[model samples]
Target: AQTVTQSQPEMSVQEAETVTLSCTYDTSESDYYLFWYKQPPSRQMILVIRQEAYKQQNATENRFSVNFQKAAKSFSLKISDSQLGDAAMYFCAYKTILAGGGADGLTFGKGTHLIIQP
Candidate 1:
């Protein structure tokens, strides 16, 4: 089984600034995918970025990036130039990579509420 932990229950950042959300995980699987998801007021889970465990490079998408420390089992999301639209609940999740190009169910963290101050 895999588990994810978000140490920060909430974080605040001024608009146009940057904020990083911390996440750590415990897993026995050797191969998997780490992900960051954002759920806004509309209650839709949006994929921010993803990092493959086998890849050494961190994943980045536009203003969203991740600091992935494989050995440390830490995956943190860094949001640059934060906007009001960024305000939402951020969740750290992971899924084990299975054989035959299959993957297991996703396990998510408790989530960190991100607040963007105008």
Candidate 2:
């Protein structure tokens, strides 16, 4: 079975600071996809970043970035100059090579609740 692991359950950073959340997964397939999703208190699932297993370079989206170590099966998210708006529950999700062929859904980790300090 493919499983995503979020080592940190909770994290906090002051306004304007930076923080990184760790994630790792176990998969037998060589080709797959990984994602970091943000769910605010409103419970809306938002895509923060995504990385394809075949890509060697990391993925970045404005203030967000990822450190993807394919061999180590690690994918961590880095939030630079974190703002109050960054406060939310971050979830790491993975899609198997065989899943999501149009009718399947995504598999997600428990989640990392981020608290922004003033």
lDDT of 1 at 65: 92
- Per-residue lDDT, model 2, residue 98, is 62
Q: Candidate 1: TM-score?
A: 0.95
User: On residues 31-64, what C-alpha lDDT tens digit does candidate 2 reach at each position?
Assistant: 9889999999977899999999999999999999
Model 2 whole-model lDDT (C-alpha atoms): 0.92
Question: In order, what lDDT does every prediction score?
Answer: 0.94, 0.92
lDDT of 1 by residue, 1-118 (tens): 7899999999999999999999999988778899999999878899889999999988889999999998899999999999999999999999998888665788999999999999
Give the 10-residue window scoring lowest on summed lDDT in candidate 1.
97-106
Per-model clash counts, in order, read: 0, 0
The TM-scores of all predictions, comma-separated, are: 0.95, 0.94
In candidate 1, position 91 carries an lDDT of 96
